[model samples]
Target: MLCVRKSYALPTIILICLTYFLFANLPPGAESPSVNERTESPDTPDQANDGRLHFTKKSEKYPVSEYIPLPTAAPSPIPQIQYDFPPESWWGRRQRVKRQKAVKEAFTHAWNGYRKHAWMHDELSPLSGDTRETFAGWAATLVDSLDSLVIMGLMDEFEEALKAIEHIDFSTTHATQINIFETNIRYLGGFLGAYDLTNGTYPILLKKATEVADFVYASFDTRNRMPQSRWEWTRSAEGLGIEPSRNTILAELGSLNLEFTRMTQLTKDPKYFDAIQRIADEMEDAQKKTRVPGLWPLFVNAQDMSFPDPRFSVGGMADSAYEYLPKEHMLLGAQTKQYRKMYDAAMDPIKKRLLFRAMTRDGKEVYFPGNIQATLSPGRETLEPQVEHLKCFLGGTVGIGAKVFDRPDELSIARKLTDGCIWGYDIMPTGIMPEIMYISPCKHLESCPWEEKKWYKDVRDRLAKGAQLEDLTGMAKSLIQKHGLPPGVTQIADAQYKLRPEAIESVFIMYRITGDQELQDAAWRMFRNIEKMTRTEFAHAAIDDVRDPHTEQLDYMESFWLAETLKYFYLIFSEPDLVSLDEYVLNTEAHPFRRPTAA
Candidate 1:
């Protein structure tokens, strides 16, 4: 359904080669007519988000000059004392009978502890980690756990917690931006699960889920295509200056609308389907203006999607939505005509012609997967090659980065690419991922047997060492996105840290989705690695110095990666189609839409 305008086919491979030849001689990271100088957004230390700060979305040259306030919610109702869990039959009587009680306990404990505080009391504490109703700042992730919980007959507890989540609001900081996205996305997840459980009908819980979406939509304006990554953490949600790039927020919103529309088809609500149309329109505008005939760059912050600026290098977010559309729609109804038309037009030539097969020194396409799936850690940005360009191509064909399997003609092709990167770049076997991998770095990849191999090896190794090396989930994303990824590349990957829980998580997703015996082998390998690398002593998830003596950093607890790792691991062994049919991101602040009508 998605139409790629310019594919390399068998002919353009020639043009790509010609382009490669012309630029191949240039030094890596050499400036091209295509790669523009980066302009930084002006920093206004004093301006803030609560209607007290104001900044334009596109201009990076100046600081915010004004401020606006956010709307204040009336005091929310008393938090519910209790909630319901799905019954034994929901998850199959056999498993439900065994785990229902445990789920009830977990949900109840989480609910009671979560419900005690008021949003009035340090609701802004998400940045500081306040106890009153926060789900580790990544609540949408819990939506998956919630589904499992419901099946295990613990929906009651979720309903109670859901009530609490509906009431809390994040109006400031990057976390606020993320939370805003999550609430909307999660509400959709919850709505879908409820529909499935209730036999294609909306229940009371569905309405509650819609309420969450409605509140988020009301808080953010869909008309304003460009969204700020951060707003002030004050009562009046004003002076929202645009962040570095708005595509991540915007794409997340657009993708969510697609989900809602498909939900509408099932539930017969025109509203859900129509909800994302405007965002889609915005995306169209963005494509026309920014079309590089290759990939969209990172500097798009326009209120008008019709005009995506091409001067900047694209980042990770946009790529995520583009490549994810096909399969995700099958799960969320992404196959619909309206959504398919929208995405196809946006993908353009990059899907076909511009996609590369190896790394080159210049920013020209050479392949090697552009960047390794290195994790971004707190504060640090960029690997050695990226240097000042700290951001890795998080998701690359568009900005966030896209996974590749174009030459599916050979299963060995993907591995060949991986080998080029891993062996050549001296990539860490320990699991840290970079946000981007440019065509060219510097002297290295000496280990690679061939030119391509050498290039990839150098790229991955430099990135792993320089990168925080924690977000290995990219590997899983790549596996499913690329399709038919071997177990070794997907699961048995390198990490920045000798001991990486994130790597385990990647293995989990890979194994769950593929159901390949190789993936199972990878999972077993991951299980053993985790056992050897981490220790459970003194009631904490601490690092194992004896085995994973890579870093001496002692203040280690199971990071969010660990939770995700466990989630995937349990899923691979427990559920087969865990993430195959869903989009990984959700954004609420980008749009104000009615909830999904599908049950």
Candidate 2:
């Protein structure tokens, strides 16, 4: 009797559950409304056709109101300089178009070679068709070349590159250590520039950029929040202790603001900006305390954030630090005045102490920024008459700074510095500047003559350290004949041409700022010479010596060859409005970050 009652009850319960479940999730309009419900009118607001409730009306008790805007002053207007750009008759529209096409073809040739041989590597060994993992095997050339592809209207190649970018896991790399400065400028700058240029159409780039920023941000984990310029990521990941170096290179430490600030602008995360701003504040406070009152040394004591080294240069160890000051001011929309103040303070001393005229055989009026050796006394500082191809970037830096800051004197100085670099390329047998060289200095900046007696004296002083007249004379003659060296050029310190972009970088800036057609012609000649010398079956390779026209090709090609060098070359031929200086600020790597409009 109990079993019979249980079975009957179970069947009754099952039938009741089925009936309830069937009615609960019926399709809309399948079931009729309850008797108490009223039909919704078409005019009814906040009513969902799916029968879900929504609160659309504002609450009477807690009314929302407009918020006050943040206070900000409008940025000063950029002075309109009437540039003397070559007219169509002078530049010739057909010739301009033809040059542009040639540049595009060159880029395509190199890019295709990279794709075929070193698609996922840091660099392509153009000579051997091999790949090198110079930067964590991160496909550096691909990321670095993103904006260039967009600028050149190479959408097909850009899309193909995107497929590789999407899979890059920046958090983990084969590289045991990474250069924070290089990573920031090349990868972070490249990502943000591509993102801004595309107007947020590609969110993946920003995602990748954030990943890279986060990865490098770990290097800033210190008591002072100063980053480790050369970060050992493998050790850091393994929970080993890592800290900022006691001695840090100025350019490596200070060149990070531009890229990190841009990251903050796009992501709205202040951590990236704060990390770099702390370094900037440290630099600003220490600016006047250095051995040279206004200039900082090549290396700084990171513990105290002081300039302990007496060597000062606008070259390798210190180039981009000063370059970023005015650019950061521009990037921040000139709202921050410290960068402007820092730039002005630094430039005054740079112009007065570092710049010197080179006594050319042709007596061309040109100037180069030389390194300084600070002494105990301020006036006793000595100048080293060595110029670096890297320092050629100063020409463009000052040119744009002059226009932005409204300094006409600096503009003239900028032209002379640019001409100095062009002279370097022009005099070289391969028509490419050497990595570093020594030159004869002019006593006067404004006026210089080819002092034949002074030239011989310098040669004798340099070569007569321990050698006899025969060896010295033979060495001097060899320097003049074998290298086909120009007058004023004393020695080729590093004769290898590493496919550097600084010379053309300045030329592009000067062209944009002054609209000088002569700069365009100069850049065209430079491009032709570089293409003829460096071009390989796979891609362009660095040469063993610029003094030898048939110089042997080095296996490695730097990522900057495509990123900065070729991009600058391509933009020099492109229309001015494509990446106008007024509309964008470029990082040291030639990645263009769009400037904010004045409030």
Candidate 3:
């Protein structure tokens, strides 16, 4: 039994009108079809005389053009969404500035606490003023917070963090199996981000990024090009026993493109690119073999790349895999057709197979992607029809990719999915969404329909007396088959809210893309709830249960709470132009990397 590197983990944000302006100007790829290539060519001469006049004989003053300009035409005529809010009076602007400052203060408060008690550790236990190590004492929180500190202009904290980063000895190797996904996003992603932000002001950031990436790259030396989710740095490839039939999770295999690709771009090392790209290649192979068209099952055999679990989700095990599809394309300036094609392929199936539009108990229509169960028989799959707060990331991911790819249909999906997520928050008693939610299939209780839905409700009614979501599984073909819609979120299992960032992350994107004031207000409400519940004398801690705002604290403060959650909250309320999404593509973890200026 090898020790896995103990680490606290992880998570995405926003759009801007100017982002469209910049992205629209990017050099087109070879396969780039004009936006209107699918539409009428509009090359008719004398439109009224040519019998092209089906609509009111064409305007006399404003005749239809013989040729419509290309979709990439300069200065888009399409209207952009503007942020709706009170007038920017001096006082209003002053309060907005204060809000930004308050977020900075929250960051500083967490930073100071971490510095005093957990300076070289992964995260802080705010309740007890103690430190904990994750990723083998890598100071993950400090490194992850570097760019945020830089962004917020905490020069002194940035200097201190840099000093700590400089002294980090990546030469120390460990036999503990580290989580490749967590290490890459929080550590490698953080360093690359800080490095790019400062224009290479501190090469130590790159040095550390390369070091960690090199160490992790060892895990990819697999026969099937699927890296183990866990790795031991000391022995690198040789340490972890090579089980020919070992299964690897999809998220780990699919989420590394941005960091690895960025490394290649910065260092001109094709090996770094090749190491991760092989996984992408393997993904292309796996999709063809999997029963699901675009969605891959959660578990795939590392040796043959065959899916095992028959279950697919945009949740814990598989969330970031699908998340990176469009992002990889955007990261590389949509020049990588593999990424774009993969993304396009995944979106439709995800909507058709995994997604469901369920009516809440309160009669609101909520569209969510349920976990899919693939059977031996194709097209006979079942759905769990529940939503995880973690999966809230899908909305923003969809929204940003839609914006980049010029897919208005996908943007509509993004909006509906985001609205569904907001409904999750609204239904929670404490005004903060729970870690898991069951979107009751009951459009009407009088119908008492759907075997899964009925069983779920019965199980919950019984559970009110005392039962577990995991325990109620004795009646079906197998315990797994016994599973159904989760009894309407029976007891909000895993009730604790560990300062997760997904909901706010999507809100940030929604506000930027649609300029929807309601999302902004929702974000504010969530922030105030978290702040009110989690704030402590030293620093903030994760609350035990979002269901009960008064529930005891969890003592733990995940680094992402600082890196992503609060950062997004601050940005959602800030000026949209601060860092336009057009010029930067965000990694799955919400670390923004500069998009290519050229094709």
RMSD of each: 18.4, 16.9, 18.9
Order of models, best TM-score first: 2, 3, 1
The list of candidate 3 runs beyond 4 A from truth reads: 1-92, 173-175, 237-245, 361-363, 442-491
- Among all windows of 10 consecutive residues in model 3, the one with the lowest summed lDDT is 53-62
lDDT of 2 by residue, 442-549 (tens): 999978888865665556555454556665556566546654556788777789999999999999999888888899999999999999999999989888888888
Assess each prediction's global lDDT (C-alpha) against the native.
0.34, 0.80, 0.68
Error of 1 at 179 (Å): 4.9
Question: Stretches of candidate 1 above 4 Å error?
Answer: 1-144, 148-179, 186-204, 219-254, 262-269, 288-291, 306-315, 331-335, 338-368, 371-448, 451-515, 527-564, 575-599
TM-score of 3: 0.78
CA shift at 73, candidate 1, in angstroms? Answer: 39
> Which tens-of-lDDT digit does each residue in 1-599 have in candidate 3?
22122234211011232123112322111112234332323322222343221111121222222421111212222223233444566875776677777777887888889889888888889999988786667888888888888778888889888888877755452324567888899989999888887878888888999888876766665445456566533222212222222466778767888998888878876767776777787788667567787778887666666676678888987999988887777666555568767888788788777777655454444567788788888878767767788998989888877776668777777877787777777656567777775554543323433456444554455334354446444422232233322224433545667788988888888788887767877887777777888888778998776666578988888889778988888887687776556656667667777766652
Better of 1 and 2 by TM-score: 2
Give the true-structure RMSD of model 1: 18.4
Worst 10 residues of 1 by lDDT: 387-396
Higher-TM-score candidate among 1 and 3? 3
Error of 1 at 572 (Å): 2.1
